[model samples]
Target: MTKDQLKLRSLILTALFAAIIGIMAQLFIPLPLVPITGQTLAIGLAATILGSRYGTISVLLYLAIGAAGVPVFAEFSGGVSKLVGPTGGYLIGYIPTVFIMGLYLEKTSFTIKNAMIANTIGMIITLIFGTAWLKIAANLSWTAAFMTGFMPFIIVGLVKAFLASWIGILTRQRLISAKLLFPERLKEKDNKVA
Candidate 1:
């Protein structure tokens, strides 16, 4: 593909992933502290499939859309107020979450171990940001915030992370087969061979 063609394709893919995140957000199980949503799964998919740069771009785009008063968040909620609401921390946390996952998958071969570790780390960072935000935004005590935000979601988060890791690596393999990924990676391999 030509340079411009490659750039266009990348742009389209990034936008698609951003849309996926937005759509996935609508699938939420509302809870007291935080909504159990498919956002993390989409985040994992985008980062694993697109890698750091494009994954980060996709997430930023998703946030921008939501910040623009679009009803794209969980339970079809939206607007800038959502960003400052109790759940806003989790929304913002998606940025760093994608960065960690994408960076790890970008540099290393996808494996259950790698994906789980990276995802676990990312989930921790996201929860920390989320819990802190809950305390400040909702005026809750640290223990309260932890109980409400962190404690409730641990097992589900692990399950989602595991699913994301498995699905992401599998999707990447399909992308490679379709010639939609691994050009640069293949080039690196060829360079080593030569």
Candidate 2:
């Protein structure tokens, strides 16, 4: 398949996944500031499968949609207000996390053994930027900021990361196998990668 076809298909899939992630925001746990949702799982899945470029684009597009007043954020929240809210930093952090996770997925061979490690590292990246942004935006000290913004979601993040990594590895394997063994999707696009 041609690179262009692959890029287009990847972008479409990424956008679909972004919408799915946004919709998952409806399943939220109440807490201080931002509630937890299953969105990050989709973010990780996109990064692992689509690589950095399209994966990041997917996330950016999702945020743009939300910022444009689409109810695509957690708790059915959207618009510019949500972007400037306390959780905005965390929302923004998703962009870099997905990109970095994609880099890891591409650079290192994905295996069950490394999945947890990769997820942990990626989670840390998200939290760092998120926590820092939360601090500045909320005008709180680092400790207080982390307690309010980061602590509440640690357990949930771990659970979702585990699930994301597992699913990511499985999905990647399936896609690679399909692309190589079947190539039907490629043939439809005239043997293009997309």
Pairs with backbone N, CA or C atoms under 3 Å apart (clashes), candidate 2: 1-191, 1-192, 1-193, 2-192, 5-194, 6-194
- lDDT (CA) for every model shown? 0.82, 0.74
Choose the strongest candidate by TM-score: 1
Span of 10 residues, lowest total lDDT, candidate 1: 185-194
TM-score of 2: 0.85
lDDT of 2 by residue, 1-194 (tens): 78778666666677787887787777878777667777777887777666677779889999999999999998887999887888888788889898888777556556544565667777787788778888988899999988887887778788878887777767766776676222223222222221
Judge candidate 2 at residue 189 and give its lDDT: 22
